[model samples]
Target: MASEDLKTIIENLQKKGKMAFLEKTTPEKIEAFEKENAVTLPEKYKAWLLYSDGGELFLPAGVQFYGIEHKPLLNVNCEDRPSDDYVVIGALASGDPILFKKNSEEVAIYNLEGGKIEEDEKYSDFDAFLIDLPSGILGIGE
Candidate 1:
């Protein structure tokens, strides 16, 4: 899926009045997160933080992306992060982490039992993951 497809999905969701997003976060806060974590966020993900921060995308059972100010990333202030090389962006309903590689666009799901990425599930970037999200979660496109 492409970025245009993701935009269409959001547009449709908005047309249906089903989209929900948290308040946008400031660049300063984003910078703070980067400085504290010693990692720079990918450009697209940074854009997202500025746009919606994070929120439920499709309503009930929707993907709930984390926010900077509220519902912070899973690794925030935690010693037991899923992976030192990854930043947790959110969790699946079952609590498996949705991780984004630090200083890279790579994204994947972190399996709790395995304590590692499910390699086959990896996406090239944040937009790619989101492009697959609706169908991946609820068969929306299918």
Candidate 2:
């Protein structure tokens, strides 16, 4: 989606009780982040960065400024896993976690605290995982 459309969707979601935040990243900052991480961000993630700077993009509590636990995983490397397409974002409510998959296949929800990959299902052809923002819950996971 275009940047403006994404913003609109975020706004609508907030109206429906979803928590969202937006941040605008400058070209210099993006370059610095990449350099610091020593890896390039995926296209979708890059778009997200360009759309806004680092902050809470969607959370009812309102977006916190940079350095408020908004860490980009683009540069943080992970241990080798079976699925090269997987991009584990971070933890969430109820011990359930959120993740993004590179392939346009399915969004994987894992209960890391429970020690299991709870759910794997296809949602759309989009490249990013859209968590159930309002509930701070992911439907795919158990």
Candidate 3:
């Protein structure tokens, strides 16, 4: 579907209380994101971009703007080295949350809500991380 059409669908979903976090994104910014991460995004994720750009893809109540651009804060910290395939994006859940992963590599979910990282063994990789966003999974724990 076209970006505008997708926006409407997302908006409607939000109205029905079935979705959370919707953010707008430009094609230029998408290209910039790929360039910065040195990795191509997955088709499902691209479809998401076609629908919206940055902030909250699903939730509305907990969403907030960090700057004039309204970009959501995405934090990714690697212990050893920065992998070539890492891309972080905002995702929909109970609220607008940041999703991240290492290129095509698998990532462990770490919940930082309790002032600590909690790991979920079932999820792995960047794609998996995105898939599990609704469940409040962050990334691998230290």
**lDDT winner among the candidates?**
1
Separate clash counts for every candidate: 0, 13, 17
Model 1 poorest 10 in a row by lDDT: 72-81
Model 3 earns a TM-score of: 0.44
- Estimate, for each residue in 1-142, the C-alpha lDDT of model 3 and write its tens digit: 4445455555544554334344556567667766764556654455565454444433344322121124543333322222323333432233322333444444432233442223553244434444444345422122
In model 1, which runs have C-alpha deviations exceeding 4 angstroms? 1-9, 12-17, 73-81
TM-score leaderboard ranking:
1, 2, 3
* Candidate 1 structure quality by residue, lDDT tens digits, 69-92: 767553554432465777778766
User: If both were scored by TM-score, which would come out higher, candidate 2 or candidate 3?
Assistant: 2
Q: After superposition, how far is residue 47 of candidate 1 from its true place, in Å?
A: 0.9
Q: After superposition, how far is residue 50 of candidate 2 from its true place, in Å?
A: 2.7
Q: What is the lDDT of residue 94 in candidate 1?
A: 62
Residue pairs clashing in model 1 are: none
lDDT of each: 0.70, 0.45, 0.41
